[model samples]
Each structure stands twice: as C-alpha cells, then as structure tokens.
Target: MPLLSYSRSYSPTAADVGHVIRVECKATKRVGGGVLTKTVDTGLVLPFPPMPPRRQMLANVNEERLTPRLRQIGVFRVLTYNILAEIYATRQMYPYCPIWALSWSFRRELLKRELQSYNADIICLQEVQGDHYKSFFAPMMEEWGYEGWYLKKSRESMGLEGKVDGCALFYKRNRFILKERYPVDFNELANDFLKQVQTEYDLDYQGPSMAAREMFLSTLNKMRQRLQRDNVAQITVLEVVPANNEMVARKSQSGPLICVANVHIFSNPKFPDVKMWQTNMLAKQLERVTLNRNLPTILCGDFNSEPSSAVYEFMTRNHVPLDHPDIQHPPPQLANIYASLDLEHNIGFASAYASVFGAEPEYTNYTGAISRIGCDYRRSLTEALLLVIRSLDRCGGLRMVHTGDADSVRRAEGTPT
Candidate 1:
C-alpha cells in the first residue's frame, strides 16, 4: 500500500455552526492493465449542544413483552463499550458534540442502534449513570431479551451528593441463566489491607518521629480514599443451556459455565500504581472463581491502561511479579485476547482513522475543529478476528465459522487450509 496525505482549510460563519459539510476525495491506482479508482465521501458537522426533551417511555409501549428461549450451542459474541455518561458530556470533553448532540436525548438512540447492530449475546458497558440504567438501559434491554445488572459508585466514595457513573452488564436471558454474582470492591479490600498493616506492624512505635508517623498516617489515609473511589468490577457466572433437555443433560455432565467479568479501572494516567493494584486485585478475584469452578472466563472492560502499561502486562503474561503495597497474593495467569490471537500486528497505528487512512488521525479521543470521524478510534472487528483466528484456525471445520464482515470473509478465504 502506498501512503497518501491531503489537507485543506476553510472558514465558516456562525450560521454554519450546526450544519454538516461534505468532503469528497478520489484515489486511483493502476493494476495489471486497468486503473482502479475509489472515492470516499465524509461529512463534517459542528457539535450542537444537546437539549433534553420531555421524558420518554422507558420501553416500547406498543410491543408486547416476549419471552422466547434462545438456544446456546457454540461460541457467542461479546461487546464492551464505555458509553460516556450524560452527566460528564461537558463542552470541554466533547467540543464538537456539545450541548445539543452530546445530550442523552440525542446520544441514547444512537448508542442503542449501534449496540443493537452488534447483535452481541453479552454486552459490557462502563460509565453508565444510575438514572439512565433504570430509565433507559434496563427497560430497553429487557425488551430486547436481555437481563441487565448495574453497580454504581457509592456517594461517599465518589464525593458526590447524587448518583455517579458505573459499570453495567447485559446478557441474553434465554441463552444463559445467571448462577452467581461477585462484586469486587477495591476500597473494602484496601481497608482490610490497612487493618492488616496496622496489626502486623505498630506504626506509632516503629516511627522515628511524630512527624514521620503523621506523614505515614496521612499517606495511608489518602491511599484508602483513592481506592474507595476507584472503579469496581462485577463477575457474573452464567450457565449456558442447549436447545432441549437431552442436549442439556449431555452438556450438564461436565457442567458448562461461563464467567464474564465486567470492569472499569481507574482512569488517572498519573497514578499507574493504582491501576496496577486494581488490575491485580481483579485478576486474583477471577482466579478464585475460576479455580474453584473451572469456568471458561471472558474479561472485558475499558481498562484505561494502555497496551504497554504494567497493568496490561500483568493481565496477559503467564507470570509477573506484582510489587505493590496492597498486593498480598500473586494473580493467576490470564490470556489477553489480543496477544493470544496475535492481532498486535494489525495495530500498526494508534487510532482507527489512522489505520483506514494510512496516517495519523486528527484526534483519537475527542472531536475538534476538523470533525474527523470513523469507527470509535479502537481496533476494528476485523483486527479482533485476526487475534481470535490464531487458535481457531487449527480447527479444520470451524476455521471460518460466522465470518460476518466482507473483509473478514475475504481474509478467511485467503488463508491456507
């Protein structure tokens, strides 16, 4: 592939604030004896402040509640998204999607449609607000054959008078029945660790001076507060049921259980130690569940830590030393889907737009003056499959199972048997 770059600038008046402008580009390449030309059209729109409308029905009033059993046979799709909470959709974070476009009223339907398109059996979401969970996600998902569970950060921990954002998990009710739920609270764990420290070593007696003791106490208190306010994880075990009783009986001999852990780790880039601690804690929690039950585990979330961080290394590597004040036990070996599938090669660029355009994207996290848009700046589904195919490719019959996307099907077809 050849590299290409193009740039243009234009000035707009106040009247064009919310209007979308179309930009078109054409690329031509000579192949064999003919020329192949491709034209791409993109739209740039200014962010309009979101305006809240009247409260709408939580569920579809017209549609009857249908409870149909969906059979589970083989592997199912899973999706993880960090739907930016409405409360945090300020003008600073999203300069483009401001007051109008960023409102829950406008983004809710778009998020729903995008999520529906994925058709995933299990969905994990982060940063979902409390009211939105009751008024929107729970009811909407219930209507769509899913049972939803949400856990919000406590008011005291969050230092907020009202509700705050938290993680939410939704699963197809018919395909899988919830067996067990273990909610991990790092804050409580930190408190327990502090108590252990206090008991094991006398802080006052060992201290060289009163100032030193005060400093130690202050540091410990701060750490405790931070941990309490940190994001939490929910681990849910679901029993996968086959179509009929006969198939279920056969499968039940081994007791098929799927453990899905949904989490949202702390986002502060400055405090990498906190992220590492949280990741290790989560790993240990998962290990306890899986070790006891021998369940197939699927961990998903907006980890907030990048691929290169110690947190990522701890999760993916077979054995790594966790040197943290709060870490008591070694975390069990867990496989990172990306590394296990060898999809790291596909991530040559930082942003999704960069991958598509073969250059650095305008912005990865937010929309700015350029208004560049593509798939959410994350690795594409095609890239994710490349990772999945590493092990599945060995299975002859199941090599190309459910290759939905055109690019993925092409890639599968091109791969040697």
Candidate 2:
C-alpha cells in the first residue's frame, strides 16, 4: 500500500506558537481476506506570525560616537547570505527539525524579514533557487529600490534536470550604479588545463614512465569532470554614486569605482585542491576584469573552505608558493578585510566574528531543535546571521549613509562603485 499523506494548519492564537498540532490519517488495506487499518501521525508547529515592522536597532550606545569618524570617508554596506534553498531542505539533511517546520512556506517570510533589516547597499546571496528568484526575491526586492541579478548553474553540467541553486547579486539602486558585470564559471579553467597539459606532453615519443603518464591523464579527466559542476561567481563593477544633493556639490574628481565579486566556492572538504583551483581561477578572472588594479574590491560569499585553508591564505597574503600542478599562476594579493586589522601583529582571524568580537566563531548555519516556535525561532536564526552583520557594522566595514566631503568621493564620467 502507498504511504499515508498528511498536512497541517496553524492555530491563530499567540499562545499556540509552540504547541504542536498532530495530524492523523487513516489507511485501510485488504490482506489475505482480512482488513488492516493503520494510522500515520504528522506533527506541525504554528510558526508564522504577522511580519514584524522593519527597524534598525543599533547594537551599541557608543555607535553614535563613531558616526562622525565614518563621515570622514564614504562607506557602504555589503551583506553576504546563503539563504538555504527551500527545495533542498530534505528530511535527511535536517533530521532534528521537522519537515513541516523546515518548509519554505514556514521559513520564507522569516528569512525575508531578516534580510530586509540589514539595509545593506550590496547584497550577495547564495543557494537562491531559480523559481524563488523569479517568483519571489526579484519582484519583492524591486519594490525596495534594489536591482537583482542571478545566474544558475547549467543543468547539464550539474547533471540535474531542473532548476539548480545559484549565486545572486543585489544592489541598492540609489547608492550605486552598475557599470559592468562578468559571470565567471570555473569549469573553463579545466579546458585551459587540458590544453596546457597537451602542449607540454610529447605524445609521439613514448617515455619510460608510460604507466605514470596514463595515471596522470586519468586524474586530469576526473578533474575536468569535477570542474564542470563548480559554482559560479558574479563579478560586478559598481560606481558609488552620491546619495544626496549636498554630496553632489562636494563630489571629488576621482569617484570611487569598486569591484564587488560575489562567489560561492566549491564546498567539499576533501577536495582542497579543487577549492584552490577555483580560487586561483577567480583571482585570474578578477585581474582580467579590473585591469586598472587600483579599484577596491570586495569578495564575499559562502566560500566553503575554512579560514585555515590554503584558499584563505592565498587570498590574504602577498605571496604563496604555487607548487600545485593544477595551479598554473600565482594568485594576486587580495586583502581580507577581517584580517587587515591585525597587520602589525600578523595574527589573522578565521572569521569576521572572531576578528571583530574577539570571540570564537559561533554556528552560522543551524540545524537543530525548535526550542520555541513563532517569533522566537525566527529571532534565533536572524540573530545568528546578524552577528556577522553586526560585526561588520561595528568595525566600520559597513555604513548605510554616504558620508565624507565631495572631494573624497571618486567620480568617473558616465561610470558606475
């Protein structure tokens, strides 16, 4: 017999938030001239509440003191979030959280409210499913004066038939103008690697290490297959525009042009080499995009590699030994804004939370019990993600307003930060 199916609804009382509503369905089957009956139980929580009023709550009373210092230079906020794709929330992945509690219907509003609270100028998002992008995020963000750009992984490369998760970039329409956008796919590097290998090898002359040569070729083929499914990066060059008329009068001759590269790198911990390869490709691509080299760049995303990984070291340091065969070129020196604070001590932190708060990194991604339902559960998730946002805000890495005199503003004719 087919498995029994069940559904649930929430009670509208504030007190009903945490209470579980159990749904039972009865199924009957005939076996060996006997009737058998079974009951299936499904539990659902009343998690949704009216959308809270959007507000920005300052974390520190002393934050007001820093406002003048921030005004000395123009600043803008960039927020990166991996809004876990709704379709991928399978029961197997989140065993502790009930499937009903984890449904997109239950989580979307909470996620949207939390994201809107940041009020960041440049927002980078990962794992945004295609349908949700078209039906939800795009139209909704447009209402808030933000333009959204998205690129999904090709289904053929990923071997998935339907919509695949991809990276998204959203910019506040008023604060910045989008100049150029380059969508990078790391898979192209694999083809380049193949060409390099072919040119370096002497196929006509059989060498003494024929067996070793075949083994190397086999590994190359495997790598090529792996690269085809690698995550993509959306590199956008934006010109920071003056937000108000007062700033326009003081605008400087050299308006700031910032290159914001948002990427979700490869995730598998076992494939450190692949991560390095992806990072290297990203660095090369960035160099090509920003030919001037002086444009301040902000690279943000869910780079699956940790702070201790080679990928992290390469991005932050001025130089590193590029001994790996797959790494064809040395990575350009890119500053990790979190680590830039400890330049004198040379003690780099693993995350923004550690760098700013001086505390061990806390869990950014949670898959656990829903201790309290409704707003409490929503607050828990929002607060955890906001910790990073808070750190960035406190450290002066992000600011909502366009501060500083016009002379400090960098302006380019017909250009866009």
Candidate 3:
C-alpha cells in the first residue's frame, strides 16, 4: 500500500488535510485515540509533487495542526552542504571544485545536477562566498525554482556604506513565505562605525579613508565583531506572515514561525579564538530568541569543535559548573540545542569526515585550494550529520528532515576533510 501521500486527492479542502493524512497513514498504534507511529516499505511510494511545486520546502506551516500527521508520516529530508564554490569541479575528480569561483562554468552545472538528484527540501550551506551568490547560485536557484534571500554577516556588512562578504540562504519559493527581515550589525549604523574605528583603532590617515591605516583597523575590528557574531546562530525566520501586511493590519495571529539558521564557526589550526567567540555569539542569539517561548529553531552549519568541547557541551546541555572559566559572558538564557536526549537519534555527531581523510573539505568561500573543499574541512556537516539533526529536537523547536547517509555518496562528489 502507499505509505505516505499528500491530502489533495484524499481531502477536498485545506481544513481537511490533517484528517486526510491520518486516515491515509493507516495508523496502527493504540495510544490515546491513535497510534503514535506506522511502518512502510523502503521501496515504497515516491510521490513527486507537481512542477512549479506549491510546497518544495515546508518552512512555513500550521505545525500545531500537522504535528500528529508528521509523526506518523514519512521522515523529513534535509541536505547540509558546503558547496566548494571557488574550487573547480575537476580539481579532485570529486566534490572539490576544479576551477576558481569566478571562472567555474560547466563544472558548477554538475554540482547543481547533484543537488537536484538528492531531492532534499531544506539545505544548509557553509563557506559560500560572494561570487557564488552573484553568479552561479542566483541564476541556478531561479532555474531550480527556488527563491533566495541572503544576509551577509552584519559585522562584514556594507549596505549603503560599502560591501563586505559572507553567507546566504535559499529555499524553494513555493514552499517558504519571506515573513520578516532584520539586519544586525556590530554598530547601530555604518557612519557611527566609522567614528568608532577612528577613535579606537587610531586615526592615522593616508590616500582615501579606505587607504588610511585607521580605516584598515576599523575594517579589522568589524571583522572581529563578525567573528563574535559567528558564536551566535544567525537565525533567519521565514514564518507565515500575511502577504499584503494583512495580519499586522488586523492585529491578529497570522501563523506559525519556524527559524532556520546558517552556521559556520572557525576550526582547528586556524584562529580557534575566532571560532569560540563567534560560537558563543550564536549561543547567545539562540538564548535571546528561545528564552520566553518554545519557538522552533533549527541551528545548522559547521562547528569545527566536536561533542566534547565547551561549545558542544553547552549546545548539548551538559551544563558547566557555575564558576566555569570560559563563560566570562553571562550564562545564555536559552536552552542548549542538543540537550534533549530523546532526539539523540537525530544529531549526527562524530569526527568530521573532512578531517578523517587527512585533509579538509573543499569550499567555495575561499580563494585558495584548501577552502574550496570546504573552508574548514574537518568541520564539514557530513561528519556530524546525525548529531546536527538530532540536536534540533531540543526545546521542541527543530526536527530532522533527513536520516540518510552521506557515506553512500561517492567520494568524488566532494573532497573529504
């Protein structure tokens, strides 16, 4: 029998979706008035949604109504990628890029093809630099039926002031509603930043302010802020909001909000200090958001450290002693993301695959060969895939979409860290 199916053919209206899904599940459990779970064949139904798909990624949904069905439904799938942008596709006969980001043409098409083959709804990417977004990614996303909204690291931000480089997030337009937009910079505004730099870094001038020593120091401090920002999760929420600003206009409950963060922390050998600061920053951000309520938040990306470090321990809820040394800042108000023992099955924790092969993963964010495999190869998501997903269940805010394995993918797909 068909194990999982959408409600359209089974239900006549949107309100009837849950009822339809439950009925279709053939639920077998006798808990409460229903079964908590069901079983299906591995080679069972593979239903592909119609093109111009209405819901390619389920970022915005009425989760309260759909939770029961989801538990009984098929596993949600997610893909965590650090697409080696600057690296050429042919470079390693694997995932590491063969050409530079600026000149990578046909090779990138191969990467896109692989992405489609995976058929994942939600994807998390790290070390994705500026060129990928401007060239290959922007157009390719359009072609693949995805709507893209990217926010650069605020510390590195240059909007209206000037430009700096960092990260981006993409989701299928049909599946996500762009509900809110907020940009956080180390400084309130860029001009204030200029003066702050002038005072702090020392006001030494030269050709243009851009060429002045003080200007360079100002840039350095801003990057330091970005480094700290990395400590905290850079969460972007694409929750349901009335498209015409109707909800706020009416002052009412609009819909559910799901938060998706794109994480990329520093790694070993590089500036470990930078990683710790930024990671702490991410933890602090999560604390601010989850303190008052159980808002669903999925923090995904590359953390160079393993499950044993203070950062990992903090995320997983193994609380440090009250007088722990590293916690110079206040204890974060948020619950550790990986603390929920129940969801341990989802957190894909392990030594990163990139680090295992005596090298690192290829990444697109850098201009050099090592980064093309993945900026911090030892921190590639593939290594901790299970731990990453399992940690989502903490606070009942995030859930794993995929339980699949990257090992199944050929070694040539990308460089192993």
Candidate 4:
C-alpha cells in the first residue's frame, strides 16, 4: 500500500488533565518487492491546564453607564496580534526564552488556545509566516467557522522561500460576508510613485534644464531603491449579517458595511520618513476606498510606531504639518519627500484603548530587552457601534464592540478621552 491513515477517539476525563500520554505510529509499505516498516514517536501529549479567567473589559464611566442600552443593539469582538515569526524568534534575538518555548510546534498550540479563548469576530495578525498560515492557521480558523486572507511580503526572498512573514485577516464566516479585499504592497506603491515622478521630470525638463534633471533623476533612483522594503497592508470590506428577521427589518436591507484595514509598517528605526510615507499611503488608500460611501472604518495592526510618534498623531488628529520633527531623520533627501507630502485624512478615528482608559496602555508587548506598545486600533464606526475596551493581552490586543442599532449617535458625538 502507498499509505493509509485512520483516527481512534479516546475521550479523557477531568482526571487526565495533567497526565502525559506517550504515543507512536507505525506504517508498513512494499519497497523493491520487499516489506518496509517504520515507527515514529509522536511524543508526550497532555491535556492543557485550566486557563486563567479572562480579563475584564475596562470602560469609561460614561460607557459603563450606557452598557445596558449598548447591549441591546449587538456585540462583537476584534483582536490584533503580532505573533513573533519563527525565523525571527532565534536564540540570539530572545536569549532569555527557552529554545523549546520558541519552537513553532510549541508556540502554535499555545497560540491556537489563546486565539480561540477570545472568541472574536475579526482578527488581524502580523508577522505570520507564509507556510504557517497555510499549514496551521488557515485550516485551524476554518475549523472554527472563520475564513481568512493572507498576504506575504513582496520583496526579495530572505533565506527560505516560504519563511517570509506577512499580515493576515480573519473574520467569522457567519457574522460577516466578504464584500471586497485590497492587498496593499508598499513596494509596488513605491515603484509606481517613482515611475510617475520620472515621467513628470521627462516632460518638464527638455532643454536647458537637462543638467538639473540628470541630478534629480539620480537622487530619485536612489530614493526608489531605499523605499523598496517588503512592508504590506490589507483592506477588507465586510457586510454584517443581521442576527434575525426582526433586526433585519429594523436595519437597512443591505446591512451596515465595515471597511477594515490591517497593516504591518516597516520596523526599521533609521527610516522615520519611510514609516511616515507608509502611514500616509495607507491613509490615502483608505480615503480612496471609502470615498463614495462613508462605510464605518476600522484600522488596526502593528504600526511599529509609538503613541507619541508622528504616525499616530496624523492618524488621530487627521492632520500633521510638514515640519513635524519625527519625520526629519538623518537622510535629508528622503526626509524632504515626507516633509512636503500631504498628510490629510477625513476619516475620523478614535483610539479604543485611549477612549476607554483615559490614555494608552503602558505596554502591549513584552520581551527581555524591551516592552513596548507599537500597535493600536482606530475606529470611525460610531454610527452603529459602541467600543468596549479590554486591557492589552501581552500576546495580543483586544477590543469589543456592540453593533445592530443604527440610530446611536450619542456615543460618537463626544470627543474620545
């Protein structure tokens, strides 16, 4: 026989929670007219320990008082995470962590458990390896009635072909219908921008300005090469499904649509201008997608920028001046581009954590060397939603929202704390 497989169920009781069970598999086949047998140990398996109680969601006094009214509409949860990639989780990068703890096999089981515990309607993940998404995450989410989209980084291969990491977005299949999806490759955006610039230069400078044009072209090419990092983002539009016929009748026939954008911006600190450019590009893309209709939008991901940074300022404030200090880095030429770049967006976004807790969390990520919160969620879904904020889970960040009622404008009217 080529191969055959079967499964035998062995239900365990509460008594078997911590007990270990050793298992092995044996398979036989014919090779060269002879019989070949191979046995492999699958290793010890133990029922997982009881999970700790979930952390309570923290809401401002005003929101807490309005909880009764909020619950009557609808409730859904969203989570954003930057699961450390296996390639980057090396002994050198994380010396304090045990080698076994960093292995994908061990981490995947724990990640699966942690992810499921949240029971979120939508999940945005960063640093997810291409192979891992295919082999583990996509299938696992499907088993739980979630469909997902994945986009690998678009730069040159890093050592292995399938090891490169990217961003992934998943939503509950029954809760939301996929309306549209946009995979944003920042590298491609850079290329197109440079091409446009080159064409303009060629058209403008035909005679005596040839010398200046040559110099500008040389600098532009250098900038183009520098901008080709493998960063990417995903913009998805989902139409919410009504809970019942009663709600459907109350709400519009089409149901409310949400434009959710997930991004993993470039992490290198040396190029603050690049970070600014990427953030601005995402905002422009959002403006384009939601131009015709004011679809409630939710932007969440690992931005790799701090709350006090220019990127965050532009996102929440909807405007940032050309002279913002954070956009000015050592490379004067590259910095000039961002300094003059338009940083304007009309989509009003309020940070969930800041709105609920009076300020951003102290830390959303932890490691031996550094503990930082380089991610957040911005929402303009106040027309039909109420955000219930939860404390940051070290593994990921979570935000819950209540939807369904369409006439709720009181919550969105006031400024976020």
Candidate 5:
C-alpha cells in the first residue's frame, strides 16, 4: 500500500484575462498498492466580460466658455452608481440573468474592473452589502489609494447573520482630506421630530381637554410609524488638496472644503409620500449640516423618483406646495398631513445632468422588467468650482457632461452672472 495526497488550488492572472477558467478533479482506488484516477471537469467557467470604453466629457456652449477660468480653481469628476446588492440579485427578481452571472463572486470581478476604469476623484455607490464592504471594498479601495465610509440601512438585519445593504462613499486620499462626517438615520430623525411635536403641543395647550390631546397624540403616533423607514444618507465635508504652487503662495494652509452627500431614498412607488418625506428630510439635514458656512455641495443618490415626480420638482424648484398631487396618496389621515407638510428648502440645487445635457438621460437604470431614472447628481454653487460629470449605463458604454460656476457663467442654465 502507498500513501497518496493531492493538491487542489488555482489563481488566475493577467495572462488569463480573455480566457475561460475551468477546474477538473480526479479520484480512484486501486485494489493492490497504487492509486488509479478518473478525471471530470465541472461546468463552471469564469469569463471576462468586455470592458466599457472610457467616458468622454461633453461640454455645453456655456461650459466651454468657462473651462479656462474653472481650471485655475480646481476640477474633479464624480460618479454615482447603484451596484445591485447580492441579497436582491435573486433568480425571482431577475429571471433573465443566468444563475452564475448573478452570483456575487462572479459579478464583483466585473464591478472591480468597471470601477477602476472610471478613475474618478470621488465615487458614490448604493446597495453595498455589509460583509462585502468589510471583506472586499474597503481593503481593495484602500489599495487603490481611496478612503471609504459606509452606513447600513437603519433596521434590524433581515438577511443572513443580520447582514444588510448600505451606501458606500470613497474619495481619493491624495486628492481630498475628510473634515467632518454625519451619518443620517432617517428613522431616528422621525422619532426625534415626533418628540418635538409632543413637547410643543404640551407647551402650547392651556385647556385640560383630555380627548383632544388623545386624538392629537394618536395622529402623531401614526405619522411616526409612517415615517420610520430605514433609509439613510452620508454627509461628509472634504477639504481639497491644494496645488504645489497654491500651497506655497497662500499664507493659510487650509484648502477649500466641499460638502458631499450620498443617499438612497425609499423605493416604493405605491407610497410616493414616503419618498417625498425622505427627500424633504434629507434637504433639511443638509441645511443644518452646512450652516455658518456655505460650502460648495455635491449631492449624489439613488432617488428612485423620476423627473416627472414631485420629488424631482421639489429638488429643482426648492419648494413643493402641500397640495401637490404626488403627496396626496391614500390613507386619508396621512394624506391630509402630507398635504400640509411644508416642503421647502433653500439649498438651490440644480440637476447636474439636466443642466449640462439640457435634459437627463431617458434612463439611469435599466433592466429587463423595469427601466428607471433613479441615480443622479445635484450641484450646489456656493464657491468657484468646475464639475465634469460622466455616467455609464449598466449595459451601454458611457456619457459625460462638463459644467462650471464661473463669475461670467454662474450656472449652466444662464443665471445672472
């Protein structure tokens, strides 16, 4: 009799880039003293998908004029994407996708290549899973000279080991320094708002009308429940890295700071009210976070609202009256409350895609069953800055747009410069 052992391991390299990877195993038993083996190759093969072409920035007439002026201050590219979480990438949800293609192990390789190819200054991603963030993104991004932050949805874990999806933001370490960060837990904010209402009601009421107080409290409770969805946003203030010439020329070493906000709002079309409320809450949060100083702000998110919806209108117009039809959905009591919610803000955010391209793309997100306009960037002009935004479809190649806020051209939409 002879002792036998087998080694089983393989790691792919750049040489295997365009080829399929397969594995085979063999096993057998010999009656006398030697080992015999029959080999079988499994059906699994790793195929490298084609890389998308590099994105090209498209500058409109207004942007073209301000390019030289903007370059003096600084310029950076921003990318926002919703890389579908593994938990949600199910056979039932995407029946058209092959099982192997839907697996996280396989898709992550493709994502790694896609993300690196962009070479953006800042990247905002939604649907980043907790386990993957720790095991994959954080370490991998760090190696690529990026520092990242993650905020899980504010809810008890519903998936395996209490794992859930979240939003992840990464910035080039050499390009920006983190000044401050605020993790917004919408559910917590809802509870705090309810508490404020209770305190105000107690302070204002003089009469001992128990019945009236009971009714008011009940309404407040209902509103609290309605607003307590586990959505969140990450707000960070980052100071730009100054150029070598500017560093030596300036007496103050402090560089200009920009406030960047990344969010993923509620996605239920049936409850447009929830989406609207979340958007409104985010606006208020931004207002408070950037008080005292008007930092140039870049808001990125998967709003889950279309251009035609009330959410979009409120974001661009800076106000949406209480009676807007989108805020008038069912549950008579909630409807009435939403109608009087007082949705207004002074952020003065303009859609980056709309401003540069004259309109948003027909679809920012597309799938076999549903095509949607969700992820977008909203730029707030508080300082002299230039933004060159580039986007790529999940399947299509790339689209880009260049924009700026110069003294000559304050906005892409022809505001009084």
Candidate 6:
C-alpha cells in the first residue's frame, strides 16, 4: 500500500494480509450533475479529526506525509466501541432488522460504512468477536488499505456469550509500521482480584451505595475480561512509544506522536476506589516506563467515573501527591493529554452518547443501560462509535495547511479555519 504508517501483526494469519480495495463515491450534490463519483484510490482518508486547527491541518495532509506527525509515515484511524456483544444480535431480532443478518452482514456493513466515512487508517475496536471480525470486517477493511490487531484472549467463561467485549486494533498497511504490542493481562488478573476483593455479602452489601457497587463489581467479576487499556499515558512515555516498539514509532523518532488508550472499565458500584487505584497503577507504570524521556501521551477511554473522581484528579495533576511524596508519592510524571496539547482553553469535551444521536443512523449493533437506541441496537453501537470520533475532534492537535479541499464523505460540521 502507498499509505505510509505503522503496522503490527502479532502472528500473521491469512486474515492479516492487506488487499487494495477501491471505493467509488458516486453522488449528486447539484454541483457535479450526473452523480459525479469516483474512487478514493485506496479508500485511505482522515480519521475522526480533533478540532484543533493544527490537528485539522494534520488530518488534511496527504496520507503519505502524515506518518511523521503520526510518527510512522501514516495516521492510525482507531475506533473503540462497546458492541453489547452479550445481547446476541444473531438469534434475537430487533424491530427492523433480522437477527443473524444484523449480527453478521448488517453490523459488518454498518462498520464498513463508518469506516468508509472516516477513511480511517488504523482502528482500535472493543466489544468485538474474533470469529466474526476475521470472517467479515477484515476482508472489507483490507479493501480500504490495512491489516489488523486484536487482544489475544477469549471471553468464554463469564457466560457472556459471543464476542463479549475484547479490544482489537486495525492498521492500514500504508499508514503503519508494525510496532510492539502489549496485552493488558486483564484475564490473568481478574480472577485473583475478584476472589480477594469480593465482599462476603456481594449482592447484599449494606454500606452507602455499596449494594449497587456490589452489583457493579459483580459485573466486573463477571466481565473482567474487558477493560483492557485506557489511553492515559504520561505525555512523555506516549511520545516515545516508538522507543519501546519500533513499528508503532519511527526508528529515528525524536519522539512519538500522541498515543491514545481506548479503554472501557466496568462502571459498577463497590469499592469504586479500585478503579482509581487501577488508573494510578497505570499512571505509575507509564511513569516508570517513560522516566527520563519526553513523549506526548493521551489516556482516553470510557472511565465511567464522573470527571470529579480521584482517577480524574490524579490524572489531571500528572499524578501528583495529595500529601507528601514519600507518603502519597508524587504521581510518577504523567500529564493529562489535553493539557499536554495546550490546556488553557477547553482542549476537549466529551458528550453523553445520547447527545450525539442527532438523526437516527440506518443500522446498529448494541446498547447499554445508559445508552438507548433510536434506530436499532446498532444505534448504540453507532453512538459508541462516534465517541472515538468526538474525542479526536475535540483533541486531535493538528493545524490546517490547506482549505476548501475536503474529502467528500469526510466533511466536518465546522467550516475550514
């Protein structure tokens, strides 16, 4: 692929090979009469762009040179969505779509359509099934310009049937240089943690809101397989991701572009403090990893915690000590990603999933209790999908180098700066 970027292949499978697919965008917008349409060469377009004019400029740059800002010759268009995999899009039918078709053909098509819209390079997805992705998403994504990456774990025991919620990363062959990969090791840790943390009366705790938390932790205990990695890295370590792994980072990389962690932690009630602790662990670890280095890092994910939580406080303060360094310890050396990008103004803001469901999309895959569907279960999927895009738009630190030249399907609500 002519697309320049970082690509990663854990253990190449028949599915990992990249296929050059042509996307012919035929349409009639009055300007070019007879449905003026054409191919996008390789279908490689900008991903969910952040609002910063600089990032916008980066998004506008031709795919080839994007690698430098992306620090890998290409940009990585990632998508992190919770598909509500347990809901079984196959056997059960929704109001408008068939079960199997919704799960198989239609859902894949929905993802394909979204992928087409973004011209996304690499996609980091959650709530996916291993079987279905290989069978469907891979082949389709290949035509666009890329390979794939998925967590090496299976969610079989939780009784949360189907793909249940796992993380996967896809790469456009042209936009990526395969780098090192890390497994969150959640599977290995969940059981032990649950056993140690489970309350005597798990479903019947009598503490303040602890009963609900008990239910929440039960879900974590039940679905501990999920919540892999949230994108909170010390700006320094994230900036040097190239050093640890060459593929994701350039060989001569003075530093790495921003590294994003798309995480989804279980937002149940219990010693919710555990969640913050985990964040702290991650923060401390990133500090250890990037000590003595300067790299821009971004930790983004559905933390389920209101922005006022301890994790939020710790992350924002660069993990500084609330007390004494020896006592509470100065938070290793992590800075909030948006702040790193320039924190004076609203570097970014996140919308509740409902707020973005402007007009109903045609199809969807899943929905959570907090998320309702207007079109189909896929509506939830669609909404979740937009979260990543919204994140990018709010914070993709790029500037506009050119104007009046926008990708056809890549139109943003805002006019060029």
lDDT of 6 by residue, 19-67 (tens): 4444445568777566776755443222332332332222323334333
Q: Tens digits of per-residue lDDT for model 3 on 1-417?
A: 233455534313344332323433455556677655553322222232122212122232334544642333223345666554443234453334333322445436556766787665556665555656776677877788766555554444334332334445666554455564433342333334335545644534434455566546655455444334422224666543334554462356544555566665544434443444454445555545544454455566766554434555455542333233333332232112112111111122222222222222232122223222323424433333312322234223233222222332223343322
The parts of candidate 3 lying over 4 Å away from their true place are 1-76, 87-103, 153-165, 182-233, 240-253, 268-270, 318-417
* RMSD to true structure for each model, in Å: 18.4, 13.1, 19.8, 9.7, 9.6, 17.2
Tens digit per residue, CA lDDT, model 2, 15-60: 5455554444444455556555554433443655334333232222
TM-score of each: 0.60, 0.64, 0.48, 0.75, 0.77, 0.45
Model 4 misplaced regions, further than 4 Å: 1-53, 61-73, 208-211, 245-252, 370-417
Best by lDDT: 5
Model 6 bad stretches (over 4 Å): 1-78, 86-102, 152-154, 157-164, 187-260, 269-271, 319-417
Collision count of model 2: 13
Candidate closer to the true structure by lDDT (higher is better), 1 or 5: 5
lDDT of 5 by residue, 167-192 (tens): 99999987788999999999998887
Q: Is candidate 1 or candidate 3 better by TM-score?
A: 1
How many collisions per candidate?
7, 13, 51, 0, 0, 50
Total residue pair clashes for candidate 1: 7
Tens digits of per-residue lDDT for model 4, 1-417? 212234443444465545553333544555556555454533344554444334566534434343422333245678877887888989897676556667888788778988998888989888899889989999999999999899999965578777899999999977887889999999989988788777766776666377787778777878887787889999999877767764554456665677888888887767666877888888899888886786667787877766666777887788877777767763676665554467888877767766755565544433444332133322221111112221121112334332212222222222111
Q: Report the Cα lDDT for candidate 4.
A: 0.67
User: For residue 13, what is the lDDT in candidate 6?
Assistant: 31
Model 3 collision count: 51
Clashing pairs in 1: 47-96, 48-100, 49-99, 49-100, 50-99, 50-100, 341-387
Q: Candidate 4 — which pairs collide?
A: none
TM-score of decoy 1:
0.60
265 in model 5: Cα distance from truth in Å? 0.4
